[model samples]
Target: MKIRMRTIGLIGYLTLLMLPIYWMLNMSLRENNDIMSRLAFYPHHPTINNYVQIFTDPSWYMGYVNSFAYVGINTVISLLVALPAAYAFSRYRFLGDKHLFFWLLTNRMAPAAVFLLPIFQLYSELGLIDTYLAVALAHTLFNVPLAVWILEGFMSGVPREIDETAFIDGYSLPRFFLTVFLPLIRAGVGVTAFFIFMFSWVELLFARTLTITEAKPIAAVMTRTVSASGLDWGLLAAAGILTIVPGALVIYFVRNYIAKGFALGRV
Candidate 1:
């Protein structure tokens, strides 16, 4: 009886989770009339027109390109910077080390709105406003700290004797990290990359303020659907559905590493 009840609960939870996604898919494949006529559990007559429109439209596709370009760059930069910072925090003690670590994390706590004007001014002076670099750099300010905290925890779990052993085997610091330390932390890296991608991908305020036509992200473009004609429900729903694809693909690829990543520092 207990097992049966548990099975029923699991099924119920899955149903609740999938129901909304099913609704969105249903709405995307549906015509305007079907959406307006009644609450639809599924579309009566399915059509791929929305998806087709997305591919054919330059504005729509541009958003995808811009979003991916910046988010990808931000992820790489975050990982590169955070890996070393995390290692230092985990392995060494320096003057004011604790204060510096906390200071680094304070960047994450800052509201983006507080820095918008200063960031805008700084980028403008550097002639980087409205460029991919601008948004990528902006995202790094927040993402790098998170990457550091996560990687630091993971690095701490690694025994210090591993480093000492590598040195005794005539391995240099760089060689030891590349061959030994990195492999052990692969799961942490995967998880960090996933989070950086997600945050930078969904963030809109900075992306919108920092970029114009040449580098506008998808989240910004989604806002334009609501014009004088009222909300383009069909197009809006289609865009919203499409937005989930990249993130879903990323999570699918990294899902296997998530548990291991979380357990890194715990042990």
Candidate 2:
């Protein structure tokens, strides 16, 4: 009886969570006219035209390419910068270390709008506007601090004796960090990369502001679906569904690491 109740509860919870995604999928399969005309659980006249449009149209597909390009760049940049900083935070003690660590979190805490004007001006002067690098660099301001926080937690969990032992074996600092330290915190790295990717991928304000056609993200392109007539409901829904795919794949790959992170209290 207890097991049955738990099973039923789990099913109900999952249904609640997936309801919106299922609704979007349903909407994506119907024409915009069909969608706005009725409220239905399933599409009576199903179509794949929306997905077809997204694939066939350069403007639609390029938005995805640009988004992925910047997101990838941001994730790599954040991880590269954060790993060393996290190691320092985990292994070393310096004057005002706690204050400095807190300061990094404060950067993460600040709204994206706070940095928007300054970043836009700086990039404008550098002629980086409308480039993938612009949005990627802008996202780093937030992602790097978060990456450091997550990585530091995992790094601190590692024993100091590992560093001492590696040194005794004549391992150089960079070699030890790469060959030894990183593997020990692989789960953390996965978790951090997943977060950085998600944050950059979903962030619209900076990406939308920084890029025009050359580096426009899918989120920005979604805005184009709205026209004088009305919203292209089916296309909008399909784009949303496609937009979810990358994050879903990332989650699937890093699921084990995420589970471990939760177990280790580092998520």
Which candidate wins on lDDT? Answer: 2
Taking all chains together, the TM-score of candidate 1 against the true structure is 0.93
What tens-digit string does per-residue lDDT give for candidate 1 at 1-267?
999999999999999998887778888898766788888677778888888988899988899999999999999999999998899999999999999989988998999999999999999999999899999999998899888988888888889999999999999988899999999988788888888898899888899999988899987887876664576566778888999999899888888776755553444
- Give me the candidate number with maximum TM-score: 2
lDDT of every model, 2 decimals: 0.87, 0.91
Query: RMSD of each candidate?
Result: 1.8, 1.8
lDDT of 1 at 118: 97
Worst 10 residues of 1 by lDDT: 258-267
